[model samples]
Target: MKALVKTEPGPGHVELVDIPEPACRPDIGVKIEVKYTGICGTDLHVLHDTFKNYPPVTLGHEFSGVVVEVGSEVRRVKSGDRVAVNPSTAVVCGTCEYCLQGYYMFCPIRRGMGHGVNGAFTKYVAVREDQVYKLPDHVTLEEAALAEPLACAVQAIEELTDLHAGDVVLLSGPGPIGMLCLQLLAAKGCRVIVAGTSQDRLRLDMALRLGASLAVDVTAEDLQQIVLRETGGIGVDAAVECAGAGPSVLACLNAVKRLGRHIQVGIIGKEVTLPFDTILYKQLQVVGTLAHSQKTWVRVIKLLNQQKLPLTDTITHKLPLSRWQEAFDLCERKQGLKVFLSYDE
Candidate 1:
C-alpha cells in the first residue's frame, strides 16, 4: 500500500512511500478503503512541524471511505459499508472521565489519527471500529469527507459558544473551518459578518453566497466600521475567530460587544502578542475550542443527511493521492477551498 507518510521530524519531511497494508485487529479494528480525503489546516501544521505529529505516520484525518473489512468485535459496520471517521477517538483511554462524557479529545492519553497514529491519506487505513461512522443514504463520499470539519464547527458554535437567533456575529477568516462555522451560524438564524484579508477574496465571496450578511475584506476596508454598521454601533453579539492570525483575533475582540461571546476556533500554533486587558475590561465570555465531540459528529451527520447545507461549493480542488504536493500547495496559497485527495486509479 502507498501512503503519505511524515517520515521524520521537521518541515518538508513527508513523502509517498510504499508500506505494508494494514490489518484489522480481530477485536476492535476496521480496515477501510479510502475514497476522498480532504486536506485540513491541521495537516498543513503537521507538514510544517508547527503541530505535533509522530513521524512515520500517515497524514490525513478528514476522509470518507468504504469498509473493506471489519474486525470480529465490530458490530456497527460490515464489508461494503460507506463511512466517515471520527479521528479524535483513534486512540484514547476509554475509561477516562472525558471519554465517558463523549469528549474523547480530552481523554488523558488521547492520540488522534494523522497526528498520533497512522491516518487516512492512503489506499487503506485500519482504525478502531468505534471511530467509524456510517454515512447517511443521501450523503455522498465527497460530502462525507467533510463531516470531520463540520463536526468541529458544530462543536465550536452550537456547543461551546453562546449564540441566539437574530444575533449579529463576526466570523473571522473564511477558511474551510470558518466557512463551515458560517453555515452553522446561518442555520441558527444569526446575522453574520464574515471577515478576511484581500487574499481571501474568493473565500469571502463564497461566505456571502453561503448566507453571510456581509463579507469584509479586512485588509482594504475597516472591519470595525462594518461591524458597528451592521449592529447599530453596539458591536456584534458574538465573534468567532477562525483565521488563527493575531490581527484577526484582535478584530474579533474589538468587534464583539462588551460582555458578548468570543469563541476561538482556530489553532494559533504560536503565542502572539495581544491586548490581554481587553478580555478583562470587556467582561467577555471567551471560550477556546478544539476537536469535535461524539455528540457533535452525530449532529453534523444529521445536518448533512437532511440536506440542510450546500457544501459542494466549498470543495474547489480535487487531486489524486499521487499529487499530494500539489494539493498542499493549493491549500498553502489559499487558492480556493477544501482540497480533496482521491484514491481513484
Candidate 2:
C-alpha cells in the first residue's frame, strides 16, 4: 500500500512511498480502507521538527474510511459501514482512580494514534474498533474526514468553556479550525467576532455568512480600539486562539474581557512569550486542549446529522491519494482552508 512516510522531521521531510497494507486480526484490530485524509497543523509541526515527534511515522490523523475487515470482537462496526475515527487513544486499567472518575486523557497509558502509532495516511489502517464511529448516510466520505478535527473543535467550545448566549467571542485566525470555532460560537447565540489579516478576506466573508456578526482585518488601523468600542469599552466575553502564531496569542489575550475565557486550539512551534501580568490582572482563564474524548466524537456525529455544523463549507480542496504531497503543500502554504486526500472509489 502507498503511504506518506515521515522518515525525518523537518520541512518537506514527508515522502510518498509504498508500505505494507494493514491487516485485520481477530484479537488485534479492524482493518479500514482509508477514504479521505485531512492534513492538520500538528502534521506541519512534525514536518518542521518544531516539536518532539516520533520518526518513520505515517503522518495523518484526521481521516474517514470504510470498514474492510473486522476483528472477532469488533461487533461495533462491520464491513461496508462508512466511519470516521477520533485520533486520541488511551488505555486504562479500569481500576485506576482517574479511569473511575472518567478522566482518561490524563491516563498514564494515553497515546495518540498518529504520534504513538502508524496513522491514517496510508491506503489502509488498523485501529481499535472502539475508536470508530459510523458515518451518517448524508455525510460524504470527504466530509466524514473532518470528524476528528470537528470533535476537537466541539470539545474546545462546548465542554472546555463556560460560554453563554449573547456573549461576545473573538475568534483569531481564519484557518479551518478558527472558522469552525466561529460557526460553533454563533450556533450557541454568541455575538461572534472574527479577526484575521487582509489576506483572509475570503475566509472572513465565509465566517460572516456562517453567522459571525463582525469579521475584521486585525492589521487594519485602529482595530483594537474598534473591537473595544464595539464591545462597549469592554473586551469580548471570550477569545479562541486558533492562529498558532506568537503574536496571535498575545492578540487573543488583549481581546478578551476581564476574567474572560481563552481556548488555545492552535499549535505554536516555539515557546510563546505571553503577558502573564495582563492575564493575572484580568483574572483570565487560559486553557489548552489536545484531541477530543469519545463523548465529543459522538456529539460531532450528532451535530453533523442534524445539520447544526456544516463542515463542508470549510472544505476547499480535495485531491487523490496519489497527490497527497500536493494536498499537503496547499495546507502548508495556507492557500486553502481544508484539503483532503481521497483514496477510495
Candidate 3:
C-alpha cells in the first residue's frame, strides 16, 4: 500500500511511499479500502508542523470507504458494507469519564486517527469495529468522505449550542467547515450572515448559495453595520467564529447581541490577544467546542439520510492521490472549498 507519510518533523517532510498493507486482525477489528478522502485544515497544519503530529504516520482522517475484510470479532459491519469512520476511535481509554459518556474527544488518553496514529491517506486503513458507521445507499462515498468535518460542525451547532429556527446567526470565515455549518444552520431556519475577507470572494459567493442571508467582505464592508441592519439593530442571536483569526473572533464577540451565543468552531493554533472585557460586558454565552462525539456522528448521518443539504455544492476540487500536494496548495491558497482525493485503484 502507498501511504502519504510525514517522514520527519519539518515544514515539508511528507512523502508518498510504499508501506506494508494493514492486515485485518481480530484486535484491529476491520480493514477498509479507502474510496475518497477529503483534505482538512488539520491536514494542512500537520504538513507545516503547525499541528501536533507523529512522524512516519499517514496524514488523512476525513474519508469514506468499503469494508474489504472484517476480523472474527467484527460483527457490526460486513466486508461489502460502505462505511465512514470515527477518527477518535483508533486510540482512547475506554474507562475515562468522557469516553464513558461517548465523548472520546475529551478523553485524556485519546490519540486520534490522522495525527496521533496512522490514518487513511492511502488505499486501505484499519479501524475498530465500533468506529465504522455503515453508510446509507443514498449517500455517495465522496459525500461521506466529508462526514468527519460535518460531524465536527454537528458537534458545534446541533449538540453544544441553543440555536433555534428563525434566529439570526453571524458566521465568520467562508472556508469549508464554515460552509458546512452555514448549510446546517440554514436548514434549521436560521438567517445567517457570512463574513470574510477579499481573498474569500469565491467562498463568500458560495456561502450565499449555501443559504447565508448575507455575505460581508470584512476588508471592504463593515460587518458590524451589516449585522445591525440585518437584525434591525438588535444584532445577531448567535455569532459563530470559524476563521480562527483574531479579527474574526473579535468580530463575533462584537456583533452578537448581549446574552447571545458565540460558538468557537475553528482551531486557532497560536495565542492572540483578545478583548477580555467583551465577555464580561456582553454576558454572552461563549462556548468552546472541539471534535465530534458518537451522538454528533449519529446526527450527521441522520442529516445525510434526509438529503436536505446541498453538501456537494461546496466540493470545488477533486484529484488523485499523486496530486495531494496540489490539493493541499489549493486549500492553503483558498482557491477552492472542499478537495477530495482518490487512490490509484
lDDT of 3 by residue, 216-238 (tens): 99999998998888888988999
lDDT of 3: 0.90
lDDT of 1 by residue, 1-345 (tens): 889999999997999999899988888889999999999988999999988889989999999999999877899999999998888788888898888989888898988889899998999998888788898777899899998998989899988877889999999999999999999899889999999998899898899999999999988998899888878889999999999989889989998898988999988778899998998998999999986888898788788889788777789999999999999999998996999998647
**Reference-based TM-score, model 1:** 0.97
Clashing residue pairs found in predicted model 3: none
Error of 1 at 39 (Å): 0.4
Candidate 2 wrongly placed segments (more than 4 Å): 9-11, 90-104
Alpha carbon deviation, residue 274, candidate 3 (Å): 1.3
Clashing pairs in 2: 10-47
lDDT of each: 0.90, 0.80, 0.90
Residue 128 Cα positional deviation in candidate 1, in Å, after optimal superposition: 1.7
Residue 194 displacement in candidate 2 (angstroms): 0.8
- Greater-TM-score candidate between 1 and 2: 1
Whose lDDT is higher: candidate 2's or candidate 3's? 3
How many times do residue backbones clash in model 1? 0
